[model samples]
Target: GAGIKSLFGGEITQYVTMMEESRDEALQRAIEHAKDLGANGIIAIRFDSNEISDVMQEILVYGTAVVVEKE
Candidate 1:
């Protein structure tokens, strides 16, 4: 899954807020996907983002979903 946000203004605070929100949403979606796949946890997590337009950015989160058992 992915999260997208648009740059609303030139304010640095707004940019930081939007970037964080997008990252968090993307991570949440990734976690949900892992759970749906019956994974006990996710490893090798990675995040990437790209600018779709001058005002738009897209964030993606990916990881290996795995099940672990206690010895």
Candidate 2:
């Protein structure tokens, strides 16, 4: 299994828009990373969240991306 790493902007408490955008940004980064690594697909995706400050948080997205050989 291959791995890719991605990180997005920190989250903000009570800011739904920012939080949502951060999550999306993280996912997009992960996908781009996989693409750059020549992965044909990504699976078993997961996300992690951490508190960055009293009103801020961080979002992490990761998954297994594999390269496939076409016959």
Candidate 3:
């Protein structure tokens, strides 16, 4: 898996995929948390990624939770 990453140039496919997966998971968790708070929507969503260790990465996602009314 790691061997299929990249050897030539710019974007590494495997790393990109990993980051995408991580971000998606974090976003899902954030959404679930907002849902638990009875939020009907989320706004100003933001994401940040950091390599915490040589073999670990962390993805952080946050947003403002809001309730939408059928006014």
Please, what is the whole-model Cα lDDT of each candidate in the order they appear? Answer: 0.83, 0.79, 0.84
Instruction: Give the local distance difference test score of model 3.
Output: 0.84
Q: lDDT score, residue 42, model 1?
A: 91
**RMSD after CA superposition, every candidate:** 5.8, 10.3, 4.0
Per-model TM-score versus the true fold? 0.81, 0.69, 0.82
Q: Summarize candidate 3's per-residue lDDT along 1-71 as a digit string, tens digits.
A: 23334567556777878888888899899989999999978999999878789999898997999999998
lDDT of 1 by residue, 1-71 (tens): 12324465344666777788989999999889989999989999999989899988899898999999999
Q: By descending TM-score, how would the candidates be arranged?
A: 3, 1, 2
As a TM-score, model 1 comes out at 0.81
In model 1, the Cα lDDT at residue 66 comes to 98
lDDT ranking from best candidate downward: 3, 1, 2
